[model samples]
Target: MRWGRTPDSAVTERDDDGYADLRSYAAIGDGRTLALIARDGRVDWLPLPGTDGHPVFAALLDAADGGCVELAPVEPYTVRREYVGPTNVLASTFTTAGGSVRVTDSLNTGISGRLPWTELARRIEGLEGRVELRAAVRPGTCLGQASPWVHETAHGPVLRLADMTMAVRTLGAEDVVPGDRRIDVTYVSSPGSRQLLGLVGTQAEPLVLPPAEELDAGVDRTIARWTAWSEAFSWEGPWSDAVRRSALVLKLLLHAPSGAMVAAATTSLPESLRPREGVGGKTWDYRLAWVRDSAYALTALFRFGLREETHGAISWMLGSIRRHGPEPRVCYTLDGELPRGALEADVPGWRGIGPVVSGNPAGEQLQLGVYGDLFAIVALYVGDGNVLDAETGRMLAAVADLTCDRWQSRDSGMWELPETRHHTTSKLGCWVALTRAVELAEDGHIPGDPSRWRSEAERIRSWVEEHCWSEERGAYVWYPGTDRLDASILLHAISGFDRGERMSRTLDALREELGCGPHLYRYSGMAEEEGVFLPCSYWMVSALQLCGRTREARELMDALQDTPNDVGLLAEMLDPATGALVGNLPQALSHLALVNAAITVATTS
Candidate 1:
């Protein structure tokens, strides 16, 4: 993951055109929001105020018009960065011919927790001779969603865009001069010298510009808070480092105020590194929390002794579902609302891929697997000795009734494709739901007709075993009457389903058709569409281990989970062939899969 050193004075990457390789960026955040900082020292993608907000710094999505905050050396310099211990604070050393400088960046939080408003703090210290650094704050159109402007304010200067007021506080630099939706300054770095840069933003509220000294001090407090949370996590596995990092990534994606976990910190990062017709044009906004993702997060969080996240997720998820009543949307906003649907934004998109999208259509789709997601979380909570309120139990029983009535219908499966079908995984999801419901009923946790639930659960199992199982392919097809295989079926490996020699052979069939290098394409016929889906491949590890192939599972787990980028962060997918990270940065489901896979193998092995 090293940048190329140039023969000339400046050290730069092959992508000197402002766009960076997706793999070269690292994620830094508070629980409220996240920012992607590229190797060249650009804060490329940031959803302002909150994870679900509009991106105020969106250069990652539209390099030309997308806004960004730059805090890099004026000259070319090679850079390397790592998190400061377990904290999301980033420490990067930039070495230029004149000297080397270290930049520590963190989303400042109070000693108690997150701040009332958002503040991005950058602390600059000189480690060597002398160097010149340039700092700029450029607000973009938010992929044609908003217009940004600058104006004078009682607190020095402020930038305004789409209901957000932004102010920059500097400890050392030139005077704050506001340009066309831009602010810039230049400063010198001397040995043992220190400087601070803080960007404070508030949406639909008065921007609170904290003092430079206070912001600088808050970095330490933020680090301490992160350390406390990370230290509180418990893990005894050999892959503790990897698991801990994944947990931290999940925490970063967690919206602390709402107790909802976002899928990713970013949007519109393409699935395909190169724009292929079927692969590249598709870009999704994954900022909202999904029931499936939070359910997965719940398991990992509960396993690692992170009770706050688990409880928050459970409360938010169940409450949101209760609000939806008859059926839950595939996902929800940070504030528990449904998305309006995706629309192609005017921003040219990452590297001119075009049609950068906003909102997720899955929110409106009938992902039948959501029943399993809903029941699985509730069952986990109840199994952990927690009590479900009568209201929630009644709500869940109604959900179970709906699952029984609709499990036979064709609908968008876990993949959330436009084409509806009797996806094997979808039916299995219903089976899981009903089985868990029956358990809950028998345990006196939730109100349910155990007889009916168990009967329907068996019916779902029989239906899948009959129609979904492809005798010709010797594997469970993606849907009934198709040769296609879905990687999500691997979830069945650990879903308490009967896994026997038949399931073992299906695992092999999936590997043969979907495996590329150490990666597995998300489904049949997707090898050329995009990078291998990270979660699907990680799910393979669970499938393998549960199938009694611990050695193979461990080997694959070692290959996948142990090989993240320099910052130990992974995106939604990866071009295993080229080693380019594709899709969004530090995806929650991907990290959750890694954590759960390790937990699965550790407990089994």
Candidate 2:
């Protein structure tokens, strides 16, 4: 039940300094945590207990002292990788001179979903002539923030990492040797032979080290559940393959317990390959759940008819905001708590970019765009014939009233920079939020003053048309006074604020200024600072279709759809010239944008 084409993935190679490309990694996860496996069979990033905390295999962020578990060929080999079917489970084949072996990797789930303890299983099946392979598991020091040590006992080797204890187990291997920083094993694979390595751990509870064979069976069981879920997915639109793949990637990012989908699995991957002297830090922790991201995630989930995830996400978002707000934080923790700002850890970032961080700086920003993000999802939920409880309705009504008051105030815009200028995108977000709130009140879904909300929305429209639109640039400038451009204005087309002549011209202006063909910088002056922002590129695809340029949208989408790495995963940004992935791995916003763009084009046309 494999998905995608023949897996002739990249020819395996590392950088001169020994690191895999950001695009060369695939992800597998249980409901609670995620693990990244490089195409060359290295488990480089895994956060035990949950997706929000510190990781054992933090090599993706810190190549030095950031531990990794390697299960790769001993001899020279070429490799290819893909998810096992539409599942998060990854299977990589290493073809050496002697033969080949298919290593299937998974973080096993229980019958009822997430296991009480973390279990990582890597099962090897020989496919051709005998091939020799090496395996090593080195627990990290939490990016030099905590101490980790391996203890050899009568039973086996146990890792005491921070407050957690991990038991590493192996079976059907020819040799096993243990060292201080790592545990190493060597195995020979003959045709039709099978072997396994499994790690079981718990943070506070006792370890549940199941038999190695049981771990192998767990991989099969997880695959079966993923297949059932994929078969149930509903997407008949154009580019369904890419849409489906994006959905699967988003599902992996969703924290099942709290229903809070993280922004990305791994953080501290640099957005800019090289930092500029005046540039702000390009590395930040994105493990926090952003309201904007979840807003797009709900839309993507609804388009697929995924009722459980749709409802789960909606509940988590509203519940968190209801508990924590009069005004919402830009993002929240996976467990529904406020986050401390991104605090730098003692590790060099990917490619030696320093200032790797925990937590996220955005949690403190006042991104007025979130009002639009929040109201849009709730409007969709109620429109689908779902009834909101009185508490949520009242809560939302207050939020709408607040939006009317705050619409005129300047705050950080969608990009969440430190700047507090009167950004055009912020004004448009408030406009969309209030506009939807009035509709909800008119429809009896809420108890807000529809007249007041409607007036504010119109006023916002007038203000933006007067101030944000720049006649000199023949487009909506970044704000009122400057000739700068912002790609986020593309969202206005999707929001129905402006899909006419002006927006069409702005789209052209954006392409001419911020875009190199379909590859777009997030805003003016960011061109030399970062890679093409992946989500901004997809937003333009939606803008194109909504602005009556269907042919252009489809053609651009066709070129970009096949650009995801061999495993159908996208990073936050990519070097436009080199096509090298940059920023965080498997970013949820990137995938969400892809899903919504494909769906918008298909449904609108």
Candidate 3:
């Protein structure tokens, strides 16, 4: 069942000026970090040591100064690539006029857990006639102003950039030359010939090259681990393959040691390819965990009966709140600490979009919706026959109390925009949190003032019904005084805030106003600002199902699944005009929404 590359016909290179479309890249991770491999046999983006660590390969953002690991045919060739079944291993087949060869790529992992060292394994197998394979490993200082050099070891050559050191090993290659910033090697492979190349990285430590057999075995072990994890998934619903693949992608973004799920594997990947004064300049890092995104991920995993990931996420959130306080920050690092302020890198952004940013300033923003997001995870966990500890119960009660105190104030909404207003979605998010808190207290799972929480929840609900609904728009507006539609309201339909004709009418209004084909913008006037918000599109699918439009829901699911990259990975957003993926890659929100929407379609249909 492994999706091995079998050469069927010749492939053609499709790149616009050497820059691959964002949709043309597939991802491979070892639960610690991830790398984006393009269709043309290039490792474009990789964060070494950790998911939130500095970049070693960042060609996805800056092709010139950013480093990359490339293995491709010297001549123009067609390519076909896919992941090995139920695993993150990628096999890409390159076919030229003379011959075809298949290259297998993986982030090697240990059998028990993540390996201490970062290893990237590329196995090239000759499939047809003779073909020349060119390979190179270039190291960079994560867009920082540091120089890289090459040093020779007894075994082979090593590339070093500042604190990071990479050991390069080659098998079945000839005419290898080690350069200052890159290592170049070449080999000719005919039928039945094979070659293996490995790059292992360690920061501020002496390099230890594992034996050749051990490195080879690492690939098998990593594949076996991923397969075992996938097999254990308890989903037997429609779109099962896609759903399981989404779940696996979500698992890849999880920082296993800390149980924090990152929003994406990358940062500062521009939301648009073209530069438009203010809009094209919008790019932010997503390597940290947002409470809202994590809550959605936990809910999705819980739906598939994945207790381990659910508990891990809950434990991480609770631990963070206990350490920092009951007030929620917009996002936290993988280690549960507040992220430092954003830093503007002096590197050309993706496709020359300037102002490549690291870290995120959104950490300081007052995102009021997070209260509901955090509690929603707790409610789902307890509802699934799990018990909360005494400390967690007290934490929940405190958060609910804070929500009651702050629901009347204005703050940044779910989109995290700067202009603060009375966001109707934020109000309802508190409503959801308080409502769930009351239910938990009533069920004796938590210690809380249920009567007070219920009263506050009802008060918020009444306020929303009174002021947020727009008679002219025939749906709930983003806030009062503006007839703008927001896709975030669709989440309430999933939350059971209102599943009656009112929500159905809102769905129709959102579709008519905010939707472009199967994709949806976050709010009014956003099409010119950014790409289509991907999670909002999936939210519509769930909303349609809630409204009894089962056929429409299934159709939307099929179309939305088609939007992923060739390897079944979704970015945070997509270009409605060109269907190109935009924003940070392998986004957790998009994947989680997809999983939930598929389950909704399955259960409703």
lDDT of each candidate versus the true structure: 0.84, 0.86, 0.85
Give the range of the ten consecutive residues with the poorest summed lDDT in model 1.
1-10
Q: Which regions of candidate 3 fall more than 4 Å away from where they truly are?
A: 1-17
Off-target runs (Cα >4 Å) in candidate 2 are: 1-12
**Lowest lDDT 10-mer window, candidate 3?**
1-10
TM-score of 3: 0.96
List where candidate 1 sits over 4 angstroms from the true fold.
1-11, 14-17, 278-280
Model 1, range 1-605, lDDT digits (tens) per residue?
22212122333432544677777778888889999988778899888888778778888878878889989898768777788998899998998989999999999888677788998999999899898999999998877888999888665778999999998888877556678688887878899988887899898987776789998998888889889888998998868878888888888988998899899887778888766764565688888899999888888888887777888988998888878766877999988887778888877777777578888888988888899988999888877778988999898888888899999898989988998998888998899899999989898988756888889999988888888887789888898778989889899988967578878989999889998877889898887678888898788898899989999998997777544777788888887767887887779988999999999999888
**TM-scores, in order shown?**
0.96, 0.97, 0.96
Clashing pairs in 3: 11-78, 12-78
Estimate the Cα RMSD of every predicted model relative to the unseen true structure: 2.3, 2.3, 2.7
In candidate 3 the C-alpha lDDT for residue 442 amounts to 91
Measured by TM-score, the strongest candidate is 2
Please report the candidate that would top lDDT against the real structure: 2
Ranking by lDDT: 2, 3, 1
Per-residue C-alpha lDDT of model 2 across residues 1-605, encoded as one tens digit per residue: 11123366445446766678777788888878999888788888998888876688888877778888889888888887778887888988889989999999999998887889999999999999999999998888888877778888778888888888888778789888888767888889999999998889899777776888889899999999888889888998898878888898998999999999899988788888777876744888888899999989988888787889988888999999988997877899998899997778887777788678888878888888999999998998887779888999899899999999998888889888888988999988999899999988999989966899998999999999999888888999888899999999999899999999999999999899898757799999887889989998899999999999999999988878756777788899988777778888889999999999999999999
